[model samples]
Target: MTSTHRPDLPQLMIDEAVRAALLEDWGRAGDITSQATLPAAARASAVIAARKPGVLAGAGFAESAFRLTDASLQFEPIMRDGDRLSPGDVVARIEGPARALLSAERVALNFLGHLSGIATATSSFADLIAHTKADIVCTRKTTPGLRAFEKYAVKCGGGANHRFGLDDAILIKDNHIAVAGGVVPAIEAAKAFAGHLVKIEVEVDTLDQLKEALTAGPDVVMLDNMQPDQLAQAVEIAGGKVLLEASGGIELDTVRAVAESGVDLISSGWITHSAPVLDLGLDIEIA
Candidate 1:
């Protein structure tokens, strides 16, 4: 985790996302079940509690969901984003018109659980590699509409983010090398084409390619699927002149060894695209 800072999402972004989710869930008639069961004047209080242990994220989304459902809704965040959550922990308290509270429940918990899951998964990877200098990083394989949210969750779990999009950096892969004739031409072309502020990175699978790519001076070189021994050799070859990133086949069980290889960054796509949703539930308090 950033550890010193609280995790946050911009309110405007939260409101926009929650609004779309509400619209999708409500459909044409709006929460018909809640409307039929509860009187307009009826009021209720509810708590969003965790059903499993995890890190907290996306409290902003929960607040926005209830407020957007009905402005009068009182949504109090008992636990902020980046906080550690335990089973049965009360994350938030919601009190308002019964229909509004019930209507927004799913959308609120959906963001909370999904983002928290990514955070939790990231923490698992980060914890094992804490002793090493390498920083765990998340890749671009994120859910289509929720990349920013998922990446934020990664930050909360003590991991860093790679380029948010292709436009930000020049990443030369093997295919790009093939298209450009060789690593030298590809790096030279990227260097010439990219402006002063843009960074260049390239992926290499062998020590020979590493040797060839190093001559071009990329900002970072990704070592794809290299074993810890290979990575150690790559590190020695670079001699701190360029950042070395280890990617491919990284997992919780083997992350420590990868980090110990003396690489600067470990990039994994699984953290964002495949993390399980943390279990959370909203229960109305009888009063």
Candidate 2:
């Protein structure tokens, strides 16, 4: 399969933000322990290891953290971004002055742990539906200022991305339904207003609205909170006329069943909102 490359603007911004945060934490005085305990010329080596199984991401940013702190530091990567790692797997090896290593440790681990958590969660859902044709996707429910990095992590975990923002596609939801008076009118108005280059998707809560949305010929239809049986029936009703998306209240245990219902896409919001950070730590070797 051909891999799609997304622009790295998000990753770059995240790196800058993380570096700034590290500086904020350090202040002008720097780490007191490292400053006093270790000699100014002290050098050390260390490895960043995962304590639990997870999908790895942000190795680049993690490396950048150390480099931004002290350009003389050297980082040797054992695994690249998007690599699946088990407990005790070393992701990167670093050697630098003790003060630089100690100062950059938390900042680097924070990015790896957070991003790996998102990737791991997304990968679990993607793995659940391996036998099905439906694609696992993440919603806009992402960390503020971390959307691009989080979405990239999702992709790294084998999940696809939905529209990046309001600009990418016209998604007419329940509120739009109310504003346009009904599913048909909402879809029609959206189609009329959208440029020929844009695709329109409409969200419908019930089978009745599903019928109406189909009649209006939307490019995609989101079946919100519908049961698996209902979704199967909806898929039948759709009859391949429109792409069917199953969303809302999806958990890992229920994802495979939803995918089996023959929907074209399954979107989960929890992958970003609720995934726990993976356990990763940077241990410096005392010499």
Candidate 3:
């Protein structure tokens, strides 16, 4: 089978996203408090410091946040995305007009903290299943507009991405089965309509469903929310006939056990949607 080369994401998209965030904060009168408090010619130097440990992502977006706010601002990244960060580590150094610094600080941290949180959360799951063949994968339960950034964080944390969107693959779920009348019919419909390039996966809730799904020959089978014993049974049934994915209610405590059940992939949504932000601070000094 042939694979398609996906182009690297455009830097312009990150720049425009940063610009939009800045616009949201700036509104009609740009940084009114900063305009009133800081001198027009005053300059400040600052260090972007971490207050918690995490695997970093979104350094480029943070730099874009400051640069898009003011062309004269100096935004430098000392650490790249995927670098492991520790408390008190300096992420970057910035020197610019004081007003610009104050105005851009929150937006920069918003991107850095949120993305780093996702990277860290993914890394935790990846670490738990490191001994197994199962790969940690993130779900589409990402922030509505930030799916690209969140998926990138998953990669940064040593996890793989499943499908970027519904357009990428055919995944027949329980809902589709309900509509189509049965697992076999759903799988058949997907195969009939999907392009040759698209691979089909089916979600099975029980061993009976798994048996039915296997007969239809999907490229992958998802064992949703099954106990370890049931998953082991599914693995035996599959016997390498197709890739198996375990998903639903996956947490750090239970992920390793699920991976040990011999599934090929483990997916979780909380890694991106519910991860707490990493604590980061920008300390400034007037110079």
Candidate 4:
């Protein structure tokens, strides 16, 4: 992932997110169960161990949760983001007041598990297409509040990020074409209104539409749900004139074929939205 470079995360955003999650979990009662069962002075050591194989992400956020719960809590990450993990691997260790450790457990694991899942899912696609020039990319279908975290995980998994939002680039989808009355009108309107730096992309469903879109001079063209042969034909049609992207119904088994069809990028929403959480558990090491 990015030549083994760790994903660069914004510390302030991570801290703010952890605090919000802690607040949501704690509520006004503030982990009443932990407070009742544990002595005020009780302390413990714990390790976050992976129960399944996956790539790691969001270790920083997990540490932030513990530190936010109790300033005295000390958390050490043994594995950095984007590292490959195996079953029973110790990702991190923590030592702190018993109440705080127990109180922060869920929020910490939630981030660790969810982000790791995104990384692992993205890696599966990236790994399959490693032999090709195609790059895997994630779509906007992300968790509402956790888009940044999820997109960061995609990078950590060797996948590129699409435009962060609609504001960053001009993408004329099918409906946009329909509303603008046709591909030419949509492209003309976008070219007229868009900023100089914004790159325009248009989606086409058939070869005729691709021909029309090519004539319109978009920076990139997306071949939506095209079969391998059709994609190869589209590649020949583009003939290195513009970037090509293949999207729709992309899964682990079919991604390699799609990539091998000579597309520049393959975008999928499943990696972020449908990935199952990587199972992880924090167990007390000592008490």
Q: What is the TM-score of each candidate against the true structure?
A: 0.97, 0.94, 0.95, 0.97
The candidate 3 region of ten consecutive residues with least summed lDDT is 1-10
| Most accurate candidate by lDDT | 4
Regions of candidate 4 where Cα sits further than 4 Å from its true position: 1-4
CA lDDT, candidate 1, residue 43: 98
**Tens digit per residue, CA lDDT, model 2, 1-287:** 21456324355676687778788879888888889899999899999999999999888778888888899999999997778999999999999888898889988998889889998998899888989989888899998878888888888788888998999999999998998799998888998899998999999999999998999999999999999999999999999999999999999889989999999999998988898999999887666
- Which tens-of-lDDT digit does each residue in 66-147 have in candidate 3? 8888899998889888889999999999998999988999999999999999989998999888899889888999998999
RMSD of each: 1.3, 1.9, 2.7, 1.2
Candidate 3: deviation at residue 180, Å? Answer: 0.4
**Which has the higher lDDT value, candidate number 1 or candidate number 2?**
1
Colliding pairs, model 1 = 1-158
Worst 10 residues of 4 by lDDT: 1-10
lDDT of residue 260 for candidate 4: 94
Residues 29-109, model 1: lDDT tens digits: 999999898998999999999999999888888899999999999988899887889999999999989999999999999
Q: Residues 1-287, candidate 4: write the lDDT tens digits.
A: 23456678889999999999999999999999988989999999999999999999989999999999999999999998899999999999999799999999999999999999999999999999999989999989999989989999998888989888889999999999999999999999999999999999999999999999989899999999999889999999999999999999999989999989999999999999999999999999853
Which 10-residue window in model 1 sums to the lowest lDDT?
1-10
Better of 3 and 4 by lDDT: 4
Candidate 1, position 155, lDDT: 88
